[model samples]
Target: MQEVSATASLWKVALSLLVIIAFIPASLWLLKRFQLAQMKLGKTDIKILSVQSLGTKEKLMLVEVENEKVLLGVTSHTITHLKSFPKRGRPFDSELVQAQHEQVRQSQGDDK
Candidate 1:
């Protein structure tokens, strides 16, 4: 009858609202907890100079990210401390690399 249909619709509406309300608190709690964890774990501040993938089983990362240059730590996954950097120069420190690059260029020039 009409009464039955109206009751069913009302119940449906109530349940939907209740479920939504329940999720809001849970989502808020999860968000707050994640933010707190990140803040606690974050080691950002600078002191890292560079990094090298020394082969995967463990990565070697240079710290200070600048002129300081200190090699520190090894990891299979990610230390979060070491982070990652491409071939940015400073850390792969060596005139040898530059010399090797020049040698290659000279060879190519000779070939041309």
Candidate 2:
């Protein structure tokens, strides 16, 4: 009958929709699992060393490209090069720690 045909069509639509919904997540999972989200453009030399948030939309990033390390100021709308360092120097984290310790020592000396 026509009623049976209508019910069958509805079921077919529901099944198709469910399949499409499942396909989206499955494709995403496959992409992530295989690490295919980033397109390969030969060998990449740039590496992100560290990121520090300055505010809700601003950050400081230390990045290494080739043999030089760069300090960058990043915002939602812009990226600025703050400084660059030679690869022969101490690492970024160690220098940051050393600067912090120097600040603490200076503060303690002032408190005397």
Candidate 3:
């Protein structure tokens, strides 16, 4: 196998550092732009504490927007995909939690 010289290795590292430095400012600018755009779109200051099902068909979301509690009807096909951010918080569901715990215990027993 061929060996790399110290000067060449140093040059490669310098180039990589330069590339990262150049992208840093551009990435920051883009992120700021995105946030500014989102702000301009007029978003709500809602803190969704809990959500529950209204009935067998309709779904409801308990949202606290600007110190005011509102019952928002979740107008979506799938109730499980009601997440805006990555892992915001788990919704309350006693039956689902119990079922999941039972499944986990069963799986562990089977593995052993």
Give the distance in Å from residue 57's predicted Cα in candidate 1 to where it truly belongs: 51
Residue pairs in collision within model 2: none
Q: What are the per-residue Cα lDDT tens digits for candidate 1 across 1-112?
A: 9999999999999999999999999999999999989876996655544567767576666776443445566776556543344435644447678889999999999999
lDDT of 3 by residue, 1-112 (tens): 1356877888999999999999999999999999989876867686677867777777778767555556556655654434333332445587589889999999999999
lDDT of 2 at 22: 100
Q: Which lDDT values do the candidates have, in the order given?
A: 0.73, 0.91, 0.73
Range of the 10 consecutive residues with the lowest summed lDDT in candidate 2: 34-43
Model 2 bad stretches (over 4 Å): 27-41, 88-112
Q: Which structure among the candidates has the greatest TM-score?
A: 2
* TM-score, one value per model: 0.37, 0.52, 0.33
What are the per-residue Cα lDDT tens digits for candidate 2 across 9-80?
Answer: 999999999999999999999988667446354468987889999999999999999978899999999999
Question: What clash count does candidate 1 reach?
Answer: 8
Question: lDDT score of model 2?
Answer: 0.91
